[model samples]
Target: MAGNMFGRLFGKPKEEVSPLSTLEKLNETLEMLEKKENLMQKKIAQEMEKAKEFTRAKNKRAAIQCLKRKKLYEQQVEQLANNQLRIQDQMIMLESAKVTTETVDALRSGAQAMRAQLKTTKIDDVDKTMDEINESTEDMKAIQEALANPVGGMAEFDDDDLLTELEELEGQELDEQLLAPSTAAPATHLPSVPTARVPAQAGKAQPVRTEEDDELAALQAEMAL
Candidate 1:
């Protein structure tokens, strides 16, 4: 029966059934609710107008009853509006979730590609590193051997020997100074001595000449002639 063609196919209007696109479906639902609300509001307004006429005719009870019904109708419309807003909020959340999923997938794919690239890239410095290590090892060995067998120990020992020789030379110099003449000033204080001057004789001193002086005078008188 589901596959069979209906008997009255000509008179029946073809109900256009549109496949709802995502946002279009939500909008269409919201629009349908709005239309229903508007229709309900018009009905409420008509009731209110009828109640106003009853109030003008002094029917207070009927007016109050109409106002209460209007309030209930408004409350229902408000509830429907809230539901529409909630649906919109859900739609927004769903779209955000979809975007987040796509972003995460892209990031994951990129990460995997990076990992693959890292695996493929070759680091060719192993031999170079080993060569450097060997060279450094050889240098260290040479240094260690040089330290173990130091050249010319005598040259290093000469500093101590030279110091000993200097000490000996200094001791010899001190001995020579002690044995040498002492030309320095005396250590004790002494009193000064006065020297005497001899006085000369006057001319009355008869025969005040020595034999040598008489001899010298005679020789001078002979030479004068």
Candidate 2:
């Protein structure tokens, strides 16, 4: 029997009920309860009026009976009010739950989108791409530098060979300097003293042999040699 009951319970597919529809139902229930409570209040008032009439007619039992009926109506009205409060509370909870559900769903969607985006690119792939870019940049720079260089492969010169050639030139210069004439001043030509000099007075003292006269004599003697 239990198996049959469970089968029956699970046989029908559950209907999808939206929070809005549920809230509307709760609101309707609340309205009905409010109306019923208002009617009960009216009945209580009528009972009170009837009780008053019985008291005026001196019918104690009828008056007591009316009061009892009034008490029972009051209890039902209180119960209806409680039911309204419970329905309002349920509506508030449903509203809060609806907002929470939507927020959670939005967060879940965002997470899924982020996951999909991440799937498109991996860290290893990114690193490899960056390495390729860097390598390409370096290669491009090398090409540019090669293009900017002078066309002839001979643009580059060996420092050691250049220094050796400089040394050879310096040796040549030294040889030239050594083969040049000495750095002495040439003798100055002066007007030969008048060859037709008047004879000196026989008695005049001979001219003194000054150092300059000696130098002149030595120079003339050498030239004559």
Candidate 3:
């Protein structure tokens, strides 16, 4: 097929050609036609100037021939313009088609890559990996919290037993207070002295009373003589 296209482009009749090759040929032809049109425009201008000079010199036959040549150049320029327009239109359409083809090929390649990735990796594997990551993160957080905590700070004790012990101590303190005054020893009573006395002569020695009374009595603060 490529051989046929090449043959078609180079006039070999048996070769095929690519689309890019066809567009390149059209561009070359358009450029050549544009150059021809420019040359024909120059020729038309020259012929018109020549016709004006001949008319001024009163040469009727030469002026008519120059006018005829100018008309022929004008017709050729019109034909080249039309051909260039057609080739430009063809190039625009071909370029648009090439861009679209490339875009579709890119999308096809991306889809194939996605299919290959899906074949290698599964949804179950993704879910398992995410679950493992979450578990590992939670474990790390627990380790960090343990490191930041004070040692033996959360040790538990029996609150009811502690309250019972405190109540026993309070009861012992109350019993000690209630028995305080009764623990003292009792006071002993003794016999009282008699108020009667015998007066003697000034020269005589006083008698000593060493004997106690037969009965004991409570003494008053003030005693009568």
Candidate 4:
């Protein structure tokens, strides 16, 4: 199979030509062409002076012939200038292409190196990563389980059982309240005792009383009192 002609067209220049180098070459070429054009203009002027001298010497035809030759030389110089411009354009394009090719090759090599490194790495490394992931999962599971089922001393009394007991105590208290007396009952009264009434005797103009009578009456009165 034959390679592409464009790819094989030219060998690399002595310098690894970059865009800047291409631009520098273009500028140098332009300056060189400009200098040549200037020199050609000076030569044209000298030829015109010579042609004027020939005319002053009454040789008009020869002077005209010299001017025509000078015009041809100027045309050739203009053609050279156009060729220099074309070469500069080609160099600029080539430099851009070279930069693009180098960038692509660097990227390709980097990708190839990464793939080679990946191939060289141990397959067991993935297993180790999986094991670490499983360990973390197990730790999380353990933490979740601990949160779901609390351990040790206070585990005996859950909130539901405590709430049920509290409700039962409240029910008992309500029953006790329901059984209490509505209004307080009055205390029982004791039976009353009957007393005899003494009758008063009629007076027979009551006898005059002696001291002994008075004393006997006093003693009876004292006994009755």
Candidate 5:
């Protein structure tokens, strides 16, 4: 078997190479083959064209020789094309294999990371931590509620007592006002007359003449005239 021969040649069991490295090497080889294949095709086209030119010049022997060389070149070009196609197929397989290998490696790494985390973490620790958190939360809520409600949060207002005190004050003020002096104004005032004083000693009196006495005195004076 090929495996046995490979082992015998290596003198021991052979280790496999990385798939990605193998694929890169194959890609290089494929590019080289493509270049060589292109060169071979060019040579075939040149030989065929030369054969056509010879046939047009009416040289039968030269045309026949050109045709023979063209046939050989065509055969070589065909073989190169087949080789290039085979190499392309191999490159495709290697690229697919490399992708699959990368996917498997990524999945394996993720699985290993998960296993490491699981080893360090335990369910009992999680439960204990949750219980402590819940206890702390409940204590904080109780403290907040106690702070919100202090002692004796009531209004001090005695309505009946206040009303009785106000009425007593108002009665006392009214009684003091009533006992004060009255300030009523009189309706009218009349002017007073002064009495005349009498003379203390008697004096000679001159007779005062009335209007009739004056008329009689004038008639006597006229008769005397």
Candidate 6:
């Protein structure tokens, strides 16, 4: 709908002039008018100079005639300037219209392309594709998890049963350690007092003797007999 409007605004019959060609023609006319205006300005200045010279010579009639021609040239220059302004205004309007039409046409083309893409793609189709991908990903994850699990009948083993077996083995080891006998030698007791002693001097106390001293005294008595 918007494209139609722009086409109607910018389109022209073969007999009608296009905006570009019209702008060119206006530019040429403006240049020509400018040249004519410049020429007229120069002519006006020349007439003023002529009028000054005539006035210096005391020729009032010739000076008056030169002044009248200068006024006419000024009037023509003003008219040319007004014409140039009008042409410039027309060119600006045409260029603005052209720009607006081009902008709308670009927007219309983009809108059409977007609509085509929308038609070719559907929301349901997109959802289904995503769902398939998700399912495939989940299947892959399951396969990976299965592959990562323990192999060779290990997965069938029970954690509780293994712990019970380990506890029994530890118990048996503790029992064996408790039943074992120590291999260390027996310890002997030593008496603090001696079993026999020899008499000392009357002023001194008698010295105590150990069992080894008694054995030695018996051995000496046997040897003397």
Question: What does the lDDT read for residue 157 in candidate 1?
Answer: 60
Give the Cα lDDT of each candidate: 0.77, 0.89, 0.86, 0.79, 0.79, 0.89
The per-candidate count of clashes, in order, stands at 0, 0, 9, 0, 0, 1
Per-residue CA lDDT of model 1 for 1-225, tens digit only, reads 533446355445667643245657777887888887887788789879988998999999999988888888888788888878986886787678768878999999999999998786656566677889999999999999888764686546666888999999999999999999889958652332232444656755444556566566666666666
Worst 10-residue lDDT window for candidate 4 reads 189-198
- RMSD versus native structure for model 1: 17.2
- Clashes in predicted model 5: 0
Worst 10 residues of 2 by lDDT: 189-198
Poorest 10 consecutive residues of model 6 by lDDT?
189-198
Provide the TM-score for each candidate, comma-separated.
0.39, 0.50, 0.59, 0.50, 0.58, 0.58
Instruction: Give the per-residue lDDT digits (tens) of candidate 5, residues 1-225.
Output: 999998788788557888778778878887887788788778778878888898899888998997788788778778878887887888888789888989999999999999999988899989999999999999999999988764563335566887999999999999999997777856442322232344545676655656566566666666666
lDDT per residue for candidate 6 within 55-165, as digits (tens), equals 999999999999999999999999998999999999899999999989999999999999999999999999999999999999999999999989899989998999999
Off by over 4 Å in 2: 1-10, 121-225
Give the Cα error of residue 188 in candidate 4, in Å.
36
lDDT of 3 by residue, 15-109 (tens): 68777998999989999999999999999999999999999999999999999999999999999999999999999999999899899999999
Q: lDDT per residue, candidate 2, 38-98, as tens digits? A: 9999999999999999999999999999999999999999899889889999999999999
User: Residue 109, candidate 3: how far off, in angstroms?
Assistant: 1.2
- The residue pairs found clashing in candidate 2 are none
TM-score of predicted model 3? 0.59
Candidate 1 local Cα displacement, residue 167, angstroms: 62
TM-score of 6: 0.58
Candidate 6 Cα RMSD after full superposition onto the native fold (Å) = 12.5
TM-score of model 1 relative to the true fold?
A: 0.39
Model 3: lDDT of residue 205: 94
Task: Output the lDDT of residue 221, model 1.
Answer: 62
